[model samples]
Target: MVLNERYNYKLSYSTRNSLIMIDTILKNAGKLLVRLSAGAMMLTHGIPKISRLFGEGPVRFHDPFGLGPEISLALAIIAEVICTALIMVGFKTRLATIPLILTMLTAAFYAHADDPFGTKEKPLLFIVVFIAIAIMGPGKYSVDGLKKKKRSLF
Candidate 1:
């Protein structure tokens, strides 16, 4: 009977440990998935703006903040491309999300304000995702996580 109880305790302990591992995996995987998808989608918009910035003659674009067309375009590109790349790699994710969140806000409110809901819907969704990422943080599968682990060991 003692042997049976010992085995049962070991089994329960191992099960509990496994469940914790699974939970960690789920959280990390969820972060990675969202980060990658959001970054890639934003890039679709960003890359074109990049080309337009460099390849065009006169910088023709909207100036939502009254920052002038070229300045606004530069800001958009920075947020969409540089920041998104940082978020995807899980490097300084919360900081990276700041620019992205700002960009989405500008798009949804100032730029698309005069347009229909269809125009505003996309940026609004992006804003929500970016906000979530900012709050939850990059999980154990990220560069930030690796840095944290290294720090803990030291």
Candidate 2:
């Protein structure tokens, strides 16, 4: 009977340890994914804009809704490029998502409005993912983590 009790305790301890390890791994993975997705998204769009800014490519402005192509493009560059870097680094993630969310919404509503919903899948997906990131935050590993640590120290 005593041997059975010891075995049960050992099993419980092992199970607890495994669960803790799994949780830590998952949390870290979530952080990495969030950073990469947000970062890559920014990189994909920003690089082209940066190229245009440097006069490597023609700056194409499609202001069908009359929002002004130049203004829209400028805002896109700020949100997609600047905010994306902030999000990737996990610095002020919540704040970063605000602009990102607005940019996605503008793209979906103004730019891709004429496109069929199915055809506008890319912007739609970006909107959804941006919203998700806004809500979930930058996860465990980030500048936010450092800020949190600093806060705890004080």
Candidate 3:
């Protein structure tokens, strides 16, 4: 009976080698999804605002928090453009999420505070995604992952 159990264990171990391949595929897919979502969201919102800043549309902004329109626009551009690019490229993904999360929080607090929960749902969703990315990392396909590997070789 013991010999039979040992043989079965060996068989299972050999078959389990495929698990690594599955894990690799899943990790890559997840990385792609995260990059696309975060990157696209940032670009869609940031590009227009940036264009407005530089273009002839309107440089003036209405600050919801009563600080100043210029201040608000500057902060929004930084979080949307700089952080989004970093996140998309998987460079310092975890750290990049800090600004993204804060940006979403500010949007929710200042812009969506008086709105209904339905109106605030988008920012809330972004907050959750940013938090999840911060915790889970950018996965194996990211620059951060590559850096870790290179560092470990020493």
Candidate 4:
């Protein structure tokens, strides 16, 4: 009887551990999905602005915070392009989300302050996703994960 109980206990413990590992993998995959989708979508917005930044005529961008149109556009490009790329690869992901959150905040609030809810909705959604990423940090399937593994070997 004692040997039988020990075998049952071990089986249950092993099953519990397998479930936990599976849960962790699913969570990491979800995080990777969020990062990739957000980064790719934001790139669509940022890429168009690139032409406007260097094109012939005046800058003609939203000048929130009195920073001048060109400067505001430049900052937007940095956040939407560079920071977003970092987040997508899960490299310095939390740090990357900061600029994106700020940019989306500025867009949803100051830039579109007077606009209807429809205009504000997209930026607000981006803000939420970025904030979530910031809180969660990069997950297992990322550049950050590679760095962590390398360190663990040492």
Candidate 5:
């Protein structure tokens, strides 16, 4: 009767709301996943370089910019480690992405320039992800979003 119809309507409405919430969560999660995975992976490469930079030995590294090994390693760490961390936390995301994008460009064009396409593929993928993030921006589930919310409250 009328009671059953009301119950069905309420259930459908609740279900619709649930679906909307899940969609939102998934959307944000996608951004988070990209940030985390890219950052973590870059860290694997950066961390060892960091150790190498500080390790006791002649800094033997590719001097793509003619900047010595130390400088090159420093730049790589800044991009791969620091900027990646910033991107992961969604703090100054766009600015952070700049360094990462640059690093990938360097890797693809210079470091792996003489190598085959397969050697350059990894950096290319990072470049695409960084570019996508730069375009889309950090989602609502981010530190940037929190800052925005706070600003709006003022």
Candidate 6:
């Protein structure tokens, strides 16, 4: 009877460990999915802006904050393209999301302030995902997770 009890206990312990491992894998997978999808979608927006900014013509972009059209477009590119790539790679992910969140906020509030919900919905969704990523982090499958050599910013 004692031997049987010991075997049962071991089985239970092993099962518990397996469950914990599965949970961890799921969480990391979720993080990676969010990072990749969001980065890719935002890049679509940023990439087109590049041609507008660098093309041989006068830069004509929305100057929502009075920062001038050139500066505004530049900032958007930095956030949507540069920062987004960082987020996708899971490098300094939390820091990267900051610029993205700011950009989305500006888009939803300043640029589309008077627009209908259909127009504003996209930025709002991006804001929620970026906020969640900033809070939850890049997870164990990322560059940030692989590098434990030093203290990270996030």
Encode model 1's per-residue lDDT on 21-88: one tens digit a residue: 99989988999999999999999999899888888499998898788898999999999999999999
Sort the candidates on lDDT, descending order: 4, 6, 1, 5, 3, 2
Model 3 lDDT per residue over 1-154, tens place: 1226647534355456677688887987797698768679767887788866677755687586676876788778888889888888889998998988888887877777899989888888889888888888888777888898899999
lDDT of 5: 0.87
Provide the lowest-lDDT 10-residue window in model 3.
Answer: 1-10
Give candidate 1's error at residue 3 in angstroms: 24
lDDT of 1: 0.91
Candidate 2 structure quality by residue, lDDT tens digits, 3-88: 26646533466677887899987987787696787579667977687656557456676664566766667777888899889988
In model 5, which runs have C-alpha deviations exceeding 4 angstroms?
1-21
After the best TM-score superposition of candidate 6, give how far the Cα of residue 68 lies from its true spot, in angstroms: 1.2
Which runs in model 2 stand beyond 4 Å of their true positions? 1-18, 54-59, 63-67
* lDDT at residue 95 of model 6 (Cα atoms): 97
Model 4 agreement with the true structure over 78-149: per-residue lDDT tens digits: 999999999999999999998899999999999899999999999999999999999988899999988998
Instruction: Mark the 10 consecutive residues where model 6 has the least summed lDDT.
Output: 1-10
Off by over 4 Å in 4: 1-11
lDDT of 5 by residue, 1-154 (tens): 1226646534466677887899988988998888888888888988888888999989988888888989998999988888988888999998899988988899999988899999999999999999999997888778997899899999
TM-score, structure 3 vs. true:
0.82
lDDT per residue for candidate 6 within 71-131, as digits (tens), equals 9999999999999999999999999999999999999998899999999999999999999
Q: Higher lDDT: candidate 1 or 6?
A: 6
Q: TM-score for every candidate vs. truth? A: 0.90, 0.78, 0.82, 0.90, 0.84, 0.88
RMSD of each: 4.5, 4.5, 3.9, 4.2, 5.0, 5.0
- Provide backbone clash counts, one per model: 0, 0, 0, 0, 0, 0
